[model samples]
Target chain A: MMTTETVNVQDEKKSAFLGSISSAFQGAETYATLRKSAWDTLSKFAIPGTKTEAWKYTRVGKVINHSWMKSHGNSQINLPEIAIGGLRYVFVDGLFRADLSDELTYPGLNIRRTGENAENNLLGTLSNHQGDWFEALNAAFFNDGLVIEVDKNAQIDRPVHLVFFTSEENTASFSRNVLSLQESSSLHVFTHYIGSEHSTFSSVVTEAFVGKNAALKIDKIQEGNETAFHHVDWTKQDRDSRFDITTVTLKSSWVRNDLNIRVAGENCHSSLTGAYLPSGKEHVDNHTMVDHMVPNCESDEKYKGIVRENATAVFNGKVFVRPDAQKTNAFQQNANIVLDDTATMFSKPELEIYADDVKCSHGSTTGQFDEEAVFYLRARGIGEVMARKLLVEAFLADVITTLSDERLQTYCTEKIQQLMHS
Target chain B: MLHIKDLHANIDGTEILKGLSLDIKPGEIHAIMGPNGSGKSTLASVLAGNEDYEITGGSVTFGDKDLLDLSTEDRAREGLFLAFQYPVEIPGVSNINFLRTAVNEIRQYKGEEPMSAGDFLKLVKERSALVELDGKLANRSVNEGFSGGEKKRNEVFQMAMLEPKLAILDETDSGLDIDALKIVAQGVNAMRSPERSFVVITHYQRLLDYIVPDFVHVLYKGKIVKSGSKELALELEARGYDWIKEEVSA
Candidate 1:
């Protein structure tokens, strides 16, 4: 713990720095009190230190103390183009680029930019980003992201993609997004976070409200540069809804994602999965919390991590079944493979239940590759490299193949192989 | 041609083969019959270059290469195949794919281009038919859920696919039924040629009944105790290995 004098100095420096660049950053100041309340939350609970229980395996002080938190002004060039055929909305450095985005015209869907419309009809939700200290910081400083509304009983035929690309190494960018699906609506979403060779800091916060009998499938891919740092997302669910969420992280020198999902309604089904591959001095940590507050809802989670060289990967999955959430079928599994002797992996799969009739189980395993399987493949004339690749893919098939989309599945598989071999 | 001169091997510091010698010609099929603890399987493993067995004082010559210096896979590429007593089961690897990879790798080692997919598929169909293997079984993981007889039949199917010059069968009839034994023997007999030789290692004379060998050798305690014509197998079957043990001791 730091002394009182040092704490005050750090706070003074942080606010002074944030205040100096406040004039250059602007999105929509539609909710004055909401932004003030968000700032208050961050002040009450500052960035955590290493002594904090939740920050035991990670340290964020170095990131918070850096000068990259300063704002940038219209630092724009023609960003790298992508040929993927989807309705994409592009953002560079937390600023929307209309030249790079697609035209938003579809039935039962409503899109509005934070810069185009302050508060953007998502006023109340925007004011309530107090999940954690980092989220509060995101709420206080976030300038632009997206706000999408799906009408009741609407069914989206095509996936909507959101690309967040960054190309700065000495500044920070924060994007806050809001999504709502009324009764019986369904949609699929793809979110990509890409960075140039060196990006200093980045943060993303998403708040969702899923109505009764609604369905939402979200596939998130984080393929930033080795110098890129930081990510955070939060979501909430309503009654009788279905949520299928998948997250894949390939690169990033230091990244921490905080996902808190609350299923407030009965009979809801939620499945959360993630695959994180890191190598060569990278550090990626995922802290997920799924709260089941009502009865008869089920949730399943499986996370796989592969790390080599001196990299470290951490997975902490916490599932909580409330007192009245009976007959809940919740299963959680976390498996990891540390290839090189210098790599490290930390896996903690937790389950807390108060209902006696509920069924909940969690299993965690971390080990090296099975040598017998390798020898068997080699004996069949496959070389060592190709043999190991086949074995690794087979090991991760159960999780990565869960993606129902064929193109996306192949993309993820190739990306994983490239990173692992690199 | 294959020759073993004063072969000696050890497993975990325990000597299993002591001064064993044999000569195999290119056109002859020989049956090696032995009892338990007679170094039968050890010879098969050492010939296949299993790392568990150390060659202490031995020299094995196959064709133009010193067999001891070659790797297990290199030996396979050089037209040497071993039908293991217990074929290893590998999950998540297709049986047909494994065979094709083995065949192509062997061809590549011999400086030949890979076979086309269509031709390879045709070959698989023909080879699979030799043992009456189900078409769907080729798509399944290698020997994962196979019955004991099916596993033995798969070994013969693989042998037909690879078409090796020297095939070593180690205890191929341990637990097979009469029908499976006939099928396995038929597959091997169909592939027999003047240029390809076979060393069939078995503990019973029943397998040799279907595919008679040119000669029969009784392996007792680490050496070949007797060598005679195919009629020797029926004599050893009528009397048991104990009679051969007594004869060798005398």
Candidate 2:
């Protein structure tokens, strides 16, 4: 008798949320059935709260109460350059722009829409894990997303850049990104998120699947107006696969990026690094999880942030080692530089290990610039501003060095400089 | 060129330099010898305008300007240099870039334009050779992973790049082999000119052998208790600071 009351309350909330999601996909012909099925699954699962182990530090309940289901129709918009120079893809209001994309072709690369029944495909199957609320939401309302596939043993010479642009104001955006890498294949992926000069909340979920012996390098840049809010969730990695991901966040009213990697095969490796330069009451949160489900897996995570003004930042990193996953090596470090006294950084690093013979270490540190170093620079006649900039550059150099792409590295450097000026 | 009148400074409620006074003119190198905790380093720091020390009482006049009123960087831009006793290592900033910034900052402060990249590189090469510093070391982070002697040498290289009017060497001779000592001293001696002055703070007379001083002052208990010619350094080295301490007590 008590269960009936709880079930009834849950059922009523689900139908309303589901109806909104279904209506958002009215014009899209390809994903109608998949959206219906995802909607049904989501109706059974409640939005996760902080009590969930994976969502402990991140409070998703606060985000659910907001009007996130509001749909943004086609609107006139202009996208700002992402400070990245390359072949770019521009998506305005979830519609791809042909003028911004190139028709050039490369060997061993295929970009096209999957079949109508691609709902049961490899990536779609993985997205059903735990029936994640955000994943379901993206699936139910995703208008158009590219399906990029790499051929086995093929090496992509140039890095592929994916740019997401939006101009809908006062509305939330739901977007999806799918990337798949074949065995022994190598590719570089750049995902740039740019918002129109408007205030809005943008929700994006990206699933990347790296096959055995495959290598993938990803660079994520998030730059938007300070009034903007963005949420990003990503999953998808395999055994003997190498995934290198780095994110640079410049400005956002509120930004949260969740990156989850499961190393299911032996000898897999992951290098995750993120740098955020937040100023003027901005906030940036980065949460990462690396699961060593198999033996002989390794991961190294380094995140750095330079917070000025009254900005706030959060970094939550967790590395999990299963009981059978012996011989796992994991290292994580988060260091922040607080320029102003009011700037604050919250860092939580956790290691959950059920396996023996594993090497894991995590550490976090937050502090102002070194007085001795500043004095040394000043003693050389360098002004206060330049001295602080030099120290900040030095602080971020190690993480930036973790990036192999020279173009991205230079671009990040210039962006950091500009952020300091701003 | 410089005058200190009854200079008294305190750090963390402890008075290190008490009523110290001295005078130096251009075309002269003055060596200040003292025992441990004798405030030799404090005098150099106070001269360079270190903000940590509170100047309870003192007047330091350099080239007709009140030295204590200026900030550390202002003092530096005004042609004052201090080769730290223990140089700080700033990781990930190339030595070349750091030196170039220092040079250009000083130049700009003097109302001169920044040096061109090529000219700056040329200056770096010339100054580095003066201290036996390898070009690769200049390209590496500032003093990062540098050996003890290499760190001291890097200090001299900076001194050369800035070419300040008043250079204070704070224990620059410490932690150096004989070869490094010679190279460092040669670099300092090469920069010597009638228009420049130096205040070398050291305990041992070994460094004075290479860079001969024109005047020698014995600092005792935060004050200069004895002043003499360069020969006084040999006497102090042979007899040690104990005799000087005894003389001050008497």
Candidate 3:
């Protein structure tokens, strides 16, 4: 009888999820075949449980099985000002807001909203059904997002900002963004995912193709309410492009970021830096993977986490060096600080190597703030609270200051200072 | 300027400093020489408000304020400084930035306006030179990647910057070479004034040759057992601490 009840619960969840996905894209002839195939592939793999190797540290069954995974809205909202000079694209509740966005007139750039009128199926081609249920779910259900293209040899003076804000409660939303760059092109994206202080589910899947010798940098930040759940982020880089991805999570109970960089061509350089603070029983999981597929490539990853007041954080960083990827130099480090004994952190930095010649080193450490350092500051007349804040900022400076743009770096610095105080 | 009477402190329920007493007057430089396990560092830590040590029974008054009632930072703002024997390495915190914050905080506590950027930078340039600290080193992380001599010099530099009324130097000459010791002593000597006092704690009398303490005290087994003039340090140095132990036992 118990076995029957457990099976019944899971079957009910599966049917409900599949039903929502099929109806959402039922009339979409553009991606009808792709959507069906993706759903079929995703149904083959069950949602990860505690027994799964990659999911052992982060049990996502509860997060994925939750009931709020269907509805989305297009309510207009006020967006917070972050940058001074930039091309802005605003989205409310996962739907683009044209009135709030800027009219594009810059050279060598083009952007269009995705719908049935769109010509390409890059979403299906760029995203594969990795055993990850989140990505697979995103592929099966994502309805609309923006497709950006940069011309060859053209450099955008200012950054391109994508602001996503959640206004409804107990609703799930997904956005699939695709960006392509031509040879020697360069672009910068300052992305934000913000939500109200309610239980909102949001998933954003970004697929980027960087051509030969092109460079791209994406600074993604998540600021949601403490009660919100259901967040998944994915990005893929290609060819000899220089790619740098920085993700900072300020508030959210459940978030999963799958940041993958593919060194497809030789002599490519990629870097990923993440800074997160999980407070008050919040949980933030980051799974970063960099695949060195070609020879003469280098990658560096740094992640910093602060687990405060019974909160928890999980960092699982993986680096893959293919057999042909010789002369690869990959380095990864994850440092965390748990404020009290109640707080917990799980760090699993993994390296899967098939190459013979590589200089790679990865390390992780989790501890409380250095008492001696705090006291050293205090002994110099810094107040106790100020001292703690200073040390916390100092701990996160490595990752926070890695933003290439000076303005973006200052923005992050000020945000970090506010977070430390809050 | 500072006074400690019947100071009894312990760590982890073990008695470390038992009924220790000391008095400091303005413009006085007193050197306390002691052997191992003699509570010299413990005294320094207790005076600096390190929480690891508990005062079971004691009375500490500094600048007419109850020293035991204030926190570590308040003690600092009240004109008490401790030059740590082992300075901690705080990475990513620029030395210049932290010193500026410390100075501003102290100034704020004293009802003074914040220093301007130009003035602060100028002060930093002048102070970093007192200990012969490298300009680049002073701009990097606090004490990070600093050598032993550099760390020691940083402590002295901080002391010069803070300009405490009563400064406690705990084993400042432990790992210094001859030249570093001379330079560090010069920094200390330069800060001496009629309104400033120092409590120099060390094992050897070699540092006294440069700083020239007016009085010398012997700390043995958590208490002071002997007191005399500056020549007492020379005699103890020439004879060694074993003779002091014998004298105390007798």
Candidate 4:
């Protein structure tokens, strides 16, 4: 529907935006080839418009129209106290703060700064930049991030906490992290994102590799004030490996999460679970895909949302079974509750199976609170508001209970209660 | 303890209870027997402040409070309970958690502190045993996947926990078997006190045999056309409601 003149104008705008940011990393020497390749891809593609099929529900005009400067080194703001006990790594304004972080001296675990380490072959291998704009943006401009590697047969007793705190206004921050687990190693990670008081944009990419017989679980929590947050996760699982990821989004003005998993080996298992609660004109979008490449693999995907006030939520999940992926089991479900009449929810569950012996199913449901259930609680002397809160808590219990960490579960439950009270 | 004067209610623009009147004093168990479509369930629902039924003209006073002006939860907080014919099934909400919330909220309404966890658990054990409810069912979701008998017994169990001043059982014996009916009746009988009153609404005299009522009233159409002692229930059961309908028509 666009004329040639409009296309030319859009191309000019895209070129100007890309040129402004690309100049900042002009003489950087770390990962020079990866950075140059990502920049080339970014220059070729403009920000996806509404006409784009994958981004049809989410509009990125706010991100493209406004000019954003790179965040500076540090801020004068105080660091919030950590609620869950673990080895904490803190990053402020997209730069690692060694003074505020714990010493990198855990047994059988190696932690390196991506900017300082130039020998990580797995750093830019898993993520696909050619098809994703944000992935390319993160790879091209990431200043500093963590590289975590677990030795073979090592089992981590304590969780690893990665905190990304932003305190700058009208700025953009990028972090690219790579996590690799050797054969038979097991690790649990908790990633927390805290935003600034003023409007900002943050793009984070994490690429995880689960070796044979390895187990990796990551619980991500995103809670911020007036921010645009984008997170991209790419994971590859080998034979006899397990991968699990759960993302809980409590607060944000605008957010988008893309999760992609590749089941490359047989006898592999993958799980993707998410719970998002958006209130007060907030917008949240979650897109996920799981590819079954071999036989005898299983994948389970469930995402729930509670949209309040005039907020909007979008969920799209896709499962693909290749021709050789016989005896594959894939299940996907998306459920949403729209609290107010003005709230909106868009849910699409898709399954593409190419093998004849595969078992696949997908379903999506969207509705309001059960009025009969509400009345049943109210008739027991509980107030209407409390009744509704109890129902919401019960609805999200299944997703929250899947978290192995008891403290994290309690923290999430309390956060939900506080948000409901607000 | 409870009074209703010339009560009129309508559901979906159709009148269900017209010019119905009833009165109950402290410690009295009154049985109201009626044929099908005689507004027995409608009266129970209207008294419990159900929003579906519009009170076109009515006056209901419970313990010096304007019952009609209170909301559904407020009615419960003011010591009024309705044992539904078909109990609602709420998945994922445990029965213990629900009862604890109800107990604390009711206590708060009375300006009392919340019950301690130890005492609350003890009370749950004691009250659940009163209805012969399985201990496992007490910890499960509220009435979810319960059988016909278990659901009815759960209704009685909840009533025992709330300890309302005026309890209205709306066809509690509809789907209950003989054993379940007796267990439910026994549970109700155990909770009877000098300050608590009951209004038992039923179709047959079977439930009255277990939980004897002091007075019996026959409802025809929308009003009580005949009022008598326990003998009236037996007479109506022995014969049918044809005499009452013919008497009302004449």
Best by DockQ: 3
Query: Residue-wise lDDT of candidate 2 within B138-218, one digit each (tens)?
Result: 999999999999999999999999998999999999988899999999999989999999999998899999999999999
iRMS, model 1 (angstroms): 2.4
**Pairs that collide, model 1:** none
After superposition, which runs of candidate 3 have C-alpha atoms over 4 Å from their true positions? A1-10, A20-26, A61-74, A226-239
Q: Provide the global lDDT of candidate 3 against the true structure.
A: 0.83
Candidate 3 lDDT, A234-276, residue by residue in tens: 4445567798888888887777777777678988889899999
RMSD of 3: 3.0
Q: Chain B alone, model 1: TM-score?
A: 0.98
Model 1 lDDT, residue A149, Cα: 87
- Candidate 1 residue spans exceeding 4 A from truth: A1-34, A69-84, A115-131, B7-20, B27-46, B49-54, B84-91, B96-100, B145-155, B169-190, B198-250
Q: Model 3: what TM-score? A: 0.95
Which lDDT tens digits does candidate 1 get at residues B97-125?
Answer: 77777888888989999999999999999
Q: What clash pairs does model 3 have?
A: none
CA deviation > 4 Å runs, candidate 4: A1-10, A24-27
How far in Å is the alpha carbon of A90 misplaced in model 1? 1.8
lDDT of 4 by residue, B1-250 (tens): 8988988999999998888888899999999999999999999888887899999997999999999999999999999988988788887789999999999999999999999999998888898898899999999988999999999889889999999999999899988889999999999999999899999999879999998999999887878888999999999999999988989888
Per prediction, fnat is 0.27, 0.84, 0.84, 0.55
Order the candidate numbers by TM-score, best to worst.
4, 3, 2, 1
